[model samples]
Target: MSRLLLSTLVVVVVIVVVVVVVVVVVGVVGVGVVVVVKVVAAAVVEENDYVWKNGNHAEKTYLFLVTNTLT
Candidate 1:
């Protein structure tokens, strides 16, 4: 009787863990999709290719230079 109860408890724990994992994976994938879509949209509208090494990003606003002063 004790063995059966232990086995049932283990099975329940495993099911709960599986559910939590599935939910987390789905949430992560959803967020990734949104980010990719935004990046693609930004890439389409912007002229310069952007990356981390270029000090460029999809979220940055363009600044038009109006004046320059040098000594």
Candidate 2:
């Protein structure tokens, strides 16, 4: 009976660990997707390619410039 209980506990622990790992991986992947989408959308909307300073003006640029400048 003790052995059976131990085995059940172990199984439960393994299942919990697996679930936590999966959740973390999914969260990380979701964040990555959001960042990529934001970047791509910014690039498409800005119409001024990121890192291109040619013929640049202050106000016409997108919000990326402010963050880029700070970085």
lDDT of 2 by residue, 19-63 (tens): 999999999999999999999978765655543445456544554
Off by over 4 Å in 1: 47-71
In candidate 2, stretches whose alpha carbon ends up further than 4 angstroms from where it belongs are: 48-71
lDDT of 2 at 15: 100
Residue 1, candidate 2: alpha-carbon lDDT: 100
TM-score of each: 0.56, 0.65
lDDT on C-alpha atoms for all candidate structures: 0.68, 0.78
lDDT of 1 by residue, 1-71 (tens): 99999999999999999999999999999999999999987875463334223644442333222112211
